[model samples]
Target: MLMAMRYHIWTEGCQMNEADSAKLAAGLARLGYQEASRPEEADLAVVNTCVVRQKAEDRAISYLGYLRHLKEKRNPGMRIAVMGCLVGPRVDDLKARLPFVDIWARPQDFDAILRELVPENDLGGEFWPETFPEPRGPTAYVPVVHGCNKFCTYCIVPYRRGRERSRTIEDVRREVAYLCGRGVREVTLLGQTVEAYGKDLPDRPDLGDLMAAIHDTPGLLRIRFLTSYPKDMTEHIVRSVAELPKVCEYFNIPVQAGDNEVLARMRRGYTVEEYLEWVDRIRELVPGCAITTDVIVGFCGETEKQFQHTLDLLERVRFDKVHVAAYSPRPGTIAWRQMEDDVPHHEKMRRLHAVEAVQERIASEINAALVGTVQEVLVEGERGGKPFGRTRSNKLVHFPGEARPGELVQVRVTRASAWSLQGELVAAAAPAGS
Candidate 1:
């Protein structure tokens, strides 16, 4: 009997990318491919690439180039596939540049490509999955929708990802039940703008309704969603999060610019006041929730005064984490076409550092306040002779203890830092009430 074709998949970029990878992996397994521990042992390799940032895109391309050498050295017959945003937007260009790539697929067709890679003889054939398969993992990323309706000027997501298409609540529930049955503890509801989930769907059951249904699912410990648009962060979702016990308090909302004019140029829809109001609502609903965000330091036409406004917003928001990105002009973004990339590299760097410094100061203060308080941490793993976990707010808390991944524990924070917290184990795998 022929040995199972070994498959190795390397995922890069967002949670969405990870989710897409899992789907592809599951689809491959159904097609009789087994997971390969080492890339060299694999008959097929898939690189799930990201294009959210210029650096990320550059890294993915560089990785593919490196993989070419790996293919020649190890499995000379190994078929290499590149998926995700990298290929979705530029499949033609990718095929033209890297002719060695056997399968180039988008997020939509990732599973089909993986399923088609089973036969060594058919490695060179074009591939794409005809049916979407529910994926299995300890944690699952359930994308409630695909694509972005919001075309932020600086972002390629709307253009490259196409239009929003939300899955029905029933479809999501079916996937969630499958994941739960597989012992998955966490399910992160995903979308380009998750808040806008179900708007385009025929049934039109809003995100809140979807969340309530998912939250009611058995065996799922944590329910979270991400990358919300401030414009669509409706009152209903806020109330749903506040009321739902299983729903996590952590929210990752990106307010690109603080100044209304800068936000206008970026096409972020909501004003500074509106953004703050959304934050206020979240805080009011979910007190002590760890709020994180994305901030772009220097967009085109950003003056020192506008930059100061950003700093002011940072001071007010006091985000637990800020994914700061300095603006880079991409090939075909609206910002690139209409606005000049006027901000010098040095200036952008300077502003980026400045914002980071402010974030450090704020986080330090927040962490300091937690000294001597016990917080429930979901144990992730051990590192450097210590076990580390995250609080309900997603704050990293480290303590010396013998605990396994996916276990919950309470830690009495003894020390705090801007980036992390040190604590003592108070309890292991205890209930929220206890």
Candidate 2:
């Protein structure tokens, strides 16, 4: 018997990248390639990269160099492929940079990439929606939509992933059902802007409708969505989370800046007052819901007052979690061509630290408040000699438990910190027939 040829995939960026890598892995497995534990050991390697942040893009560039060395010296016969948004529309530019790379698969050209990887293997019959494998872990990500049309001035998603294209509700429903049958208990819907799901479709089934459909699935214990735009978030979507049994009450809305002028410059499309009103509505409708946000500091022309306004928003909103980044100019963004990167690198870091400090205080207080509450957490896996899981509100919790992964458990919060919680096991929960 011939030994199976091995392949490895190095993935960078968001959950979407992870899901895409999973798809690639499945496709490669079908073509008789086993996953290698290390890149150097593989006969072929794929790198799925992101260009959202300059630092991340730089790392991807460095990895390309490393892959070139591996090919030239250690593994002369190894084939290397690059995929994902970092490849973007500048294929020739990237090709010039990495002339040794065997394949270049842009985000939109993955099918061709698959064909190149498995030219001899024709044993396929609709492997995506109906035949896709279940997530090896309990949680899975389902992309209801791909790409974006919003074209926020500082962003590159639209140019990279193309215009918004949504899968039909039936398609998403089947995918979620398949995942549930494969023992996945949780599903998080993903997209560049998930709140924009179904807008391009004929039937116009929005996210609320999609959630209601998936909420009726047999084995799914929890459902979640992420990184919503405040402008596109409808009342129906909010009410669905409030009313749906399986949907988690967690929101991750990114208000890029707090100052209206700054937001306008970023082409965010919503005013500061309008965004705050939406936040207030979510809190009013869904009490105890955990609200998380993403904030960027040092955009092209941010002033001291504008940065202060962001800090004030953090204080007022009291987000459960905040993902902060100092802006880095990317080659293709409008900010790169139109605006001056005037903020000193040190000033950007200082602003990042300042906002982080305020959010840290809020996070500590919020976690501490959960001390006596009983939280329903789906036991994910073990870490630090204890089992860790995330509450429905998306807080990380660790506790003493013999409960197996994929089962729900009630944990009484015993100790709390800003990043994670320690809990005493109350009882093993058999949620959704787990």
Could you give the C-alpha RMSD of every candidate to the true structure, in order shown?
Answer: 3.3, 1.9
Residue pairs in steric clash, candidate 2? none
For candidate 1, list the clashing residue pairs, or say none: 112-128, 112-129
- Model 1, span 13-119: residue lDDT tens: 88888888877777787677899987778888899887878999889888888789988776689999888877655568778998888887877665458445544
Question: Per-residue CA lDDT of candidate 2, range 1-434, in tens?
Answer: 99899999999998888888887787777677899999989999899999899888889889988988999999999999999988777689878878898898877465656767655434664343223643888899888889988988889878888998998998889889988988899999998889999999998999999999989888889999976989999999999999998999999999989999999989999999999999999999898899998999999889999999999999989999999999998888898889999999999999999988998899999999999999999988898778889999999999986766788999999999889999999998785345
Cα deviation in Å at residue 102, candidate 1?
Answer: 0.9
| Candidate 2: 10-residue stretch with minimal lDDT | 125-134
Task: Please tell me which predicted candidate would have the highest TM-score against the true structure.
Answer: 2
Model 2 alpha-carbon drift over 4 Å, by segment? 120-133, 431-433
What is the model-wide C-alpha lDDT for candidate 1?
A: 0.83
